[model samples]
Target chain A: MNIQLIAEIMGTVAFAISGAMLAIERKMDLFGIVFLGIVTAAGGGFIRDMTLGIVPPAMFSSPMVLPLAILSSLAVCALVAWLYKGSDEELHGERFQWILNFTDAIGLGLFTVAGANTAIDSGYGDYHAFVIFLGMLTGVGGGMFRDVLAGIMPAVLRKHVYACASLVGAICYLGLLCAMPRGYAMFTGAMIVVVIRLLASHYKWNIPRVM
Target chain B: MNIQLIAEIMGTVAFAISGAMLAIERKMDLFGIVFLGIVTAAGGGFIRDMTLGIVPPAMFSSPMVLPLAILSSLAVCALVAWLYKGSDEELHGERFQWILNFTDAIGLGLFTVAGANTAIDSGYGDYHAFVIFLGMLTGVGGGMFRDVLAGIMPAVLRKHVYACASLVGAICYLGLLCAMPRGYAMFTGAMIVVVIRLLASHYKWNIPRVM
Candidate 1:
């Protein structure tokens, strides 16, 4: 498989898991869990496609995207059921937090670059601001939807350097595209986002919030 | 101006006022209030345009939409400031509730028909399900976004028959298209939604909830 395809699959799986876990935590019904999981994986693409005027959206056109999201979400649900067995114990521990952070960072990075690349391919390469904004939006939009459905302020808007990490990575991708092969630029940009996000999480970095 | 233009303007103003009022109730900053107001006014059209593959979306291409939303929101803000005068009296009474309901219903009805018309004009008239869905989505999408930003369950999904009202109206529009002119169909459909919503609200009609 190509690197871009791999990144897309990995990002989809990670986001599905993230969304399913949140739905479970919220004690939502089975339908809600699956719905949230699918939306979290694909909602950003929907937004991106709409803005870029891609009819039917990539998620709808791609045969595997929706199926992948469904399978991943179901797998998460099965795993959680097997492990917790309906217990009320907290789902987070050190290792769990680490896993969540790692997977989320990877998903954010991959999706951000993917979105930027799509924008570039769609003739938006000249619009640096729009490209970067689309990239960041693609990375954060799903999570924002998830949070909204869960009746909470979007975490990206409130806490951490999540969106900033995506923003910086998009900028890096745009800068590198001039000096390197497209694939290399994408890889490097995504890696930068992943690294920055991981470090920010480890250091508890947060943007200033107005109280 | 055409009937469609008039409906669009009224919808924009009503939705903006609704969003601004909610923001004020939540004690958000000025920026938050305006942002929420504009999103509530234009977010649905964004979703619709995106799905229909309309580049730049109508809100961006039509200079009046955004400016109108901003001005309407600002007017609401000014009026609220003048009336409340920084006092914490509750904003709702019988008259206030009636006005809010009347305006919201009108906005919902007009937007629903407008969205369905757009869908039909885009050559999706044969797809009955898609047309109805797009219409209902246009009616409720902005309020959904507004509620999400305000950290509350979407009112359309919960209290009243808000979305259902839009759905019925869309179906009515489609049905009426066979018997009347497009303008008459749109007007009649919108009126149906407003009446249904008002009646539902007055009678406290609610869908079954899973306890």
Candidate 2:
């Protein structure tokens, strides 16, 4: 399989898991949780494709996206159940949270690059600027959507320069798009976002509150 | 003033009043009520314009919409208060509901004609069939929006087939454009919707439930 196809599957899996975990946290019913997970993973990409006048968005066009959504959601539910088993017994477990956080950071980093790269490669009168802008948005947009449906303030509006981290990743990807060897640029872009997000969270960084 | 502008203002006023009354029923704060009212009144039109590629939308672009929103909301609040004071001990008033239903029918009828006419008049392509479809939606879409935000089932999903009613109005308007004089066609079409809504509601004529 092509690298782009692998990237798409990885991104779908990462987002679907995050989406399902949120629905479980929100105490949604099983069907609702699954629906939310699928919507969250595919919503941004679906909208982006529709806006670009592309028919049958990748989520619907690709067999892999649907399977990934279902599997990822189930996996997330099982993981959450296992991790939260101790919640009623005593304190919330910190160990599971650390692992969850680690996986999430990797997901976020990888998704950002994947989204940006796809926009750039699509080559439908969308050049560098549109690609960078749209890519960063596609990466973070689904999470923002999940937050809204779950009736929480979006993380973009709340914490840690989350969208900016995506932006920086996009910039890194662009900088090295023509210069570096193929895989190096992708790796560097993902690394930038991952490190930035981890560091920003640790320091409790935030964008300036609107005046 | 343009005839189109006048019609738009009338529609905005009717929609805003309906929304404000709903917000008051919910016992929201004054700001919340006004905000809900204005957004509900204007949102569908704003969306319609955007999808038609009219950026910033006339509801935001034209100076009239915001002022009309504030005016209509305040007028509705004041009128409701006056009606309550003027009524006797039973206090089971439905004058507000009657006014909203009446004006809402007119607004829907007018908006559908305006939307389709504008598309045809603009020398827009055959793709303007989509714009006409949008127009039909814009008429009833605001109420659907208000219902969802108020935590009620959307009227289009439940009531006297609201979207279908608008579709009927659109069809009549199209027919008028084809054979009859527009003025006669417009009035007859509006009457058809208003009379149908009133008669349907009186007999508890609900749409059949589907899976």
Predicted complexes: DockQ each = 0.14, 0.05
> lDDT tens string, model 2, A122-146?
7742477777776677777777777
In model 1, the runs with Cα more than 4 Å from the true position are A1-117, A124-136, A145-153, A156-211, B92-97, B178-180, B205-211
Candidate 2 ranges with C-alpha deviation above 4 Å: A89-92, A124-127, A181-184, A203-211, B1-20, B26-211
Per-chain TM-score of chain A in candidate 1 equals: 0.92
lDDT per residue (tens digit) for residues A55-156 in model 1 = 788988988789998998899889988887856665655665566567677778888988888887898676676687678878888878887897766767
What is the C-alpha lDDT profile of model 1 across B32-83, one tens digit per residue? 6777788899889889987887765677666677778889878877887787
Instruction: Estimate the lDDT of model 1.
Output: 0.82
| Per-residue accuracy of model 2 over B34-140 as CA lDDT, tens digit each | 88678767877865665455667777788988888888888867776786665543233466566666666666666665665555554442443344465575776
TM-scores of all models? 0.63, 0.56
**DockQ of candidate 2 relative to the true structure:** 0.05
The lDDT leader among the candidates is: 1
